[model samples]
Target: MNDGTTTLPWLVIREDDNGNRYRVGRFATRAEAQRTADSLGDHEHQQLYCVERLGARKPGPEQNGTAR
Candidate 1:
């Protein structure tokens, strides 16, 4: 069974000089995510911004139509 809900697979991540990472945002498309990362990276040289795709996840109860 498929739920109507969709997940944003593209992630915009930020890594600081200390090597700590933070999730900036999620997007439906890679282009949107990358564009945001590039703009943010241009402003902050010390922090690295990049786009990554989330790994596939198994459908949970909600997605399986088990939960209300």
Candidate 2:
């Protein structure tokens, strides 16, 4: 368990019809992520993006944690 050569996976970012964004899955390749995104049901607001580990946890505008 001492191997530090392992690379983290890329994440698929999904946005729902309500404009809610979240991480859908982690993939080893962009092609795989694109496949998964394309497989999702048709939705006007739904969109997918491929990002690295550090960007996977990016929150939506509503999740900014600022009090209104």
Candidate 3:
């Protein structure tokens, strides 16, 4: 059964000057993720930090729907 509950969807992303992107962390709230991004950004001026909301996850084959 689909419980309608999702994992942490807020993402803190770090992008380097060379355009390499990395996932810093995931949070349940945007504020929490942003705070972490801000802290990291403050210490690393050469890197860009940002927060993004992940799209709702689709159900997999193990669940009720077919996997994409």
**Model 1, span 18-50: residue lDDT tens:** 879788899998888877877786663567776
Clashes counted in candidate 3 amount to 0
lDDT of 2: 0.53
The CA lDDT at 49 in model 1 is 71
Return the number of clashes found in candidate 1: 0
For candidate 2, the clash count comes to 0
Best by TM-score: 1
**What's model 3's lDDT at 44?**
31
- Lowest-lDDT window of 10 residues in candidate 1? 59-68
List model 2 lDDT by residue over 11-53, tens digit each.
6566555667687777767566656666653445435443434
TM-score of each: 0.72, 0.48, 0.69
The C-alpha stretches of model 2 lying farther than 4 A from their native spots are: 1-8, 41-68
Evaluate all candidate structures by whole-model CA lDDT and list the values in order.
0.68, 0.53, 0.68
**Candidate 3 backbone collisions, by pair:** none
Which residue runs of candidate 3 sit more than 4 Å off their true CA positions?
A: 1-6, 56-68
Q: Evaluate residue 14 in candidate 2 and report its C-alpha lDDT on the 0 to 100 scale.
A: 63
Better of 2 and 3 by TM-score: 3
